[model samples]
Target chain A: MNKKCTTDPDRSYKQPEFDLDKYIPGHSVDCVIVGYENQQLKILLVKWKLGGPWALPGGFVGRDQDLEAAAHQVLEERTGLKSIFLQQFHTFGRSDRHSRFKEQMDQVKAISQQLGTMDLKFSKWASQRFISTGYFALTEIKKTCPKPDFLSEKCEWVSLEKLPELIFDHNKIVDKTLKHLRIQLNFLPIGISLMPHKFTMQDLQKLYEAILQRPLERSNFQRKILKLGMLHRNGKLLTGAANKAPYLYSFNLEKYNSMVENGIGFSYLGDKIL
Target chain B: MNKKCTTDPDRSYKQPEFDLDKYIPGHSVDCVIVGYENQQLKILLVKWKLGGPWALPGGFVGRDQDLEAAAHQVLEERTGLKSIFLQQFHTFGRSDRHSRFKEQMDQVKAISQQLGTMDLKFSKWASQRFISTGYFALTEIKKTCPKPDFLSEKCEWVSLEKLPELIFDHNKIVDKTLKHLRIQLNFLPIGISLMPHKFTMQDLQKLYEAILQRPLERSNFQRKILKLGMLHRNGKLLTGAANKAPYLYSFNLEKYNSMVENGIGFSYLGDKIL
Candidate 1:
């Protein structure tokens, strides 16, 4: 993954000696980088340059680093977004998760032919079965300037509704991340981090609805959210809507945090919605 | 850990050479087996025979087994409980988590001396830093007869309030598991698994209070739980007191599952509880 020192490499790669002690072998970190933009929920993904399908922007944990720190580094490298809300929701350790790589051996061969060389050590090590820890990040899509790492073609925001074929268990990771987000939404007002500085009740509602994947009763959502004392009725938004101008509110940080700590409870959708 | 074949092994253990391909290196599974009895929350712990302090009843994941399967295997081996509600909550990946191994080297040495001959391979491999996935299981205490694994002393449920000195990050794992449980309570009618097959509203309320670690208004708690529609009120349980008997409720599986599927939301305790 790329941070500020974004570089592109399309040449023969030299393999390094295998040092099992230097890396937390058989484990990797995958970021389900969820973003909000244009009233749609999206995930930041990377197109591997070598021999793989598109996958979540992921990186190996440094031998010396804490997993959380590694996750932050990966997020920063992949999305150029840091200090956002990130949570380790699940760790996937299925034995057959790497079967996709075997199926994509053709792609591996094609990439090898195109690049004219493959890093032998990397090829051997990367093909091994790996258990991945999944961390989901919520950031405003506009703030992120995603750049691909040396091994990836490009990094871009893909709408969750229209995700391309992903490598390994990445598609499953994205699905789990969404489920975690929805469950978290039941107890926490989760979208303020992705919201603008000031927004109408409708804007907040839209963000929640997007994560929830369903429409919520507008006034009910507003009342429930307001009762948690998370929003400050700052002023009214001057909008193009013909109806009465909806009030603009900024998050009361203190109240929002306490509410998050105490869990603001609300239920949405049902089997009917399903 | 043993399922039913609980044989006491207070002896040194010879560790086998860890084959990298046969197992996912540097990763392990730890089960925070939480059980309830007499209105107290407890965790199943084991004492290592050759080294280490008291720790969670956990085992290694087979090379071919899924992480969840490994957790269940560990749980069943330790607690003799199978097909229970087990959730993988988090993974602990701090580099310094194994500081305890180095710090407790004296204890390891003492155990080695006591065991007459330390299995060099096992000792060296056991003390190495490991990232562990934490899975929490809730089952009725009466049904479980926890047995220690071959590598440790007897297994027993220790009250959450009076935890013994634990090896590595096991204590932190337990605390995190409880936090997960408490958070889960806001969204689901948990502790039902920890309760008797049939329980009064007061029994359920007490269980919640124990988990919540505070008092809740009785009527409010009853009203809230009843509203979830998961409880099927059976005949009332007559008591010696003159007050009206509390209704005994059985979990309506379909309704309870649906309520669990769509989170059951209610928040008790104030800002301080957080």
Candidate 2:
């Protein structure tokens, strides 16, 4: 295209001028995809290629894309899950979050040189201070195919209780998400994403315990979850160690969808299951 | 304060920085203090003195202060409520949110005259792109005394139901906060903040209804809230309207605090009253 700025009155020269820097500094998105497998609650994290530092897999939004759409796109790229139950929990904007990048400025320069990027602008963009918006996902572990990006050597589930030292303030991001999750447990269909298509009552209870970081009485857990009217008994999961086979259950999608629409109209307290 | 450039063997001179623009832009914190009073849930908003546009009561974070501390400080300055529970909800970082400030650049001279500031730095700061962290608070409406800053003409409660068109996506921020509030109703001890020290069950229910944006069944609502073991029934409120005097309630602060310290393990769905 010929230089449109020179040819048209409505082009760049006549168009609006914006002071981008004044609005807000470095903005980014970090996703915490919480999944369940083997009766354990797990979080999807990435291991860096060089330092092996784990992080809540995240990315920056493009200038042209919607902020939320960018989060969805990031989720799709990291975990092969699309249009899932995702919610924006919190935004982490503390200045020290950028301190790690500052400390590794020389390392970044060396890497850029190795990657044959002589452009100073690209380097600056890479190291710019970022304020990250946090989005959490409830995913079915078996369904997701997590792939590590260019900067990461591994992308896999790490139990929330055994979390690694995450890069930057990512651990804090996960911590915030967990708090939001605990608060929203009754309102949100957490089991739908965390559990398998068919899970035993024990499995469901364990998932809650994992997220809550405390064990709940078995009978009460069963009774509470069933009262929501969002579960359907499927069959049975036979275990040699158990005297009786626990009935397998699945989330009643119809009821779950309606609850998500109308809300569960429920609240939780000590041993007072909804 | 003389310039200390010298040719001595040990003397070295650092280059002068280009300007404020040369460094990364700073972040901003916008507060959404949702207050409950008179059967309505309201948000604190400010109308700019320089312009007629309204926005969520907000301010910039100082470089040295913690972001959360800065947010709390902003809340204290805007509303005379200190040490309130303020939580960061989301960050609005879309490039489009800066368009209004950018569009005002053409008439910078005229705008500066309206703002009455010779410091070009302040004008540049006002007009630049910003990524603002959204912080929310739950508070008793009557307890706060709203005061507008130099940039605002009015600071007052605008009912969530009948909010005016706010400047540059602040309406979106308030909406998102409400959504979070609804999800958080299960875990957060909101009555401690939004209700008076002593209130009737009806008052508490109204607050919930306002936040949930739905009318809850009265009998079920009473039972569910009561079952939480967090409310201590005080003497009934004598009303001129005359029915059975509704029993006044005050939060069992010890139980509520303990529940928050340790996770509240049970949830009350509004179906089974007892």
Candidate 3:
């Protein structure tokens, strides 16, 4: 049932440094690093050097590390970002999760050999059932310097709508993360993490539309968001058509934090729209 | 650093049957079975026969079980309820989580001996760091038949306000669960899971108040909930003061389901209340 590794076989493989004894057994962390660019929502994914399919940037939990810290480490390694809005949305622990890859033990041994490491325990450990905590991180797209790890060939941002078939249940993990982001839009200051400090009303609207996965009536959306009073209107953006320029605004952090603390009811979309 | 087992030792001990090979190594599921009664929220907890402190009714994930199915299994074993509204809230995996118990390896061995089992591997496994997924379940309080497992002495409901210090990070788990419940109030049909089939508006208000941890303005609450159109007005509850009798209502399942699917905007509580 092994899927052929059609990736370039001669791509230099770096030996993965893992101390099995220094890590927690049967548990791991997978991060869905989400960023916004060109009004499109994108997630950071890594392609394995031994390649079957692309996967979320993930790693095992350190024996002495917090689950959240493990996720943060993965986020930092892949995106070079810190102090971001990272949340543990869900834990994926179906017994058949590993088996879903449809790879055989021989494949694991071969991959281990190709990596210049013949650790039998590492191969067996990698093939065992692992309950992975899924974390979704919101980071400023322009700031991230995406880097691939020893086991990965490339680290790139993939648009949400165009996500390729991911390895194991990683696809489902991304789906779950997006669902959480939509629900959390009511409670979290998402724009603070994903948008530039000064953004136009259309930029903000597009962000909302991107997360919500639907178009909202412009006037209605603007009116509802302004009513929340967590935004401070700055000078208008000076475009070629001066009269048609939209006002630039920034989040009033104090008011925004307070509003989020009390839980904002972003019900402007109404019952007809989610 | 062992917390002494203070329960009466003379009480007959039953040998717990657990095959370590049949369970996932380092992951578990803890159920915060929440029930509402007498206008207060209550959580189901289990007291160990060889006591330290009461704990959330929890168990290891079966080698072949889904993470959620493990939570449901724990819920069914403790409360005799199935197909409940269960949700995974958070995963607890701090490096010091187990160490916070202040329990030693000797304590594990002693407990094993008391249960007529001296398997060192079992003792070691019990003492190892486990990443436990926390799930909160909402069920009708009266319908549940509370029962303890072989390792426990009593299964009982304790009011949230009066919760005794729970073992390890269980108290923290309950706190996180309550926080999630409050935030989810805007989206989930919690009333349908917790309330009786036919209930007065006052009864429903109490449920909301308990979850929100504050008294809401009555008329304002009524206006907002009624506007949602998810409740069907049924016959009036004729009391001793027939003229002052309140109307009984039930969830209009079709409308309620649709509203929930589209996400309800319960902003009536305003920014002042969470």
Query: Any runs in candidate 3 off by more than 4 Å, and if so which?
Result: A1-16, A101-113, A217-248, A251-262, A266-274, B1-16, B103-113, B217-236, B241-243, B252-260, B267-269, B272-274
On the 0 to 100 scale, the lDDT of residue A19 in model 2 is 26
- Please state the interface RMSD for every predicted structure, separated by commas: 3.9, 5.8, 2.6
Model 1 misplaced stretches (Cα beyond 4 Å): A1-21, A100-102, A105-118, A219-274, B1-22, B50-52, B105-118, B217-249, B261-263, B266-274
Question: Over all chains combined, what TM-score does candidate 2 have?
Answer: 0.70
Give lDDT tens digits, candidate 2, residues B58-86: 76665544678778877887777788878
Q: Candidate 3 lDDT, tens digit per residue, A29-81?
A: 99999999889999999987676468899887888899999998888877776
- Residue B251 shift from truth in candidate 1, angstroms: 3.2
Q: What TM-score is obtained for chain B in each of the predicted models?
A: 0.85, 0.83, 0.89
* Of 1 and 3, the candidate ranking higher by TM-score: 3
**Tens digits of per-residue lDDT for model 2, A35-95:** 8876677898987656646788876665555577777876887776678888877777666
Best by DockQ: 3
Model 2, runs deviating above 4 Å: A1-25, A98-128, A195-209, A212-252, A265-274, B1-27, B36-41, B93-130, B139-144, B159-162, B182-186, B194-260, B263-274
Worst window of 10 by summed lDDT in candidate 2 chain A: A6-15
DockQ list for all candidates: 0.44, 0.24, 0.51
Q: What is each predicted model's overall lDDT from 0 to 1?
A: 0.75, 0.71, 0.80
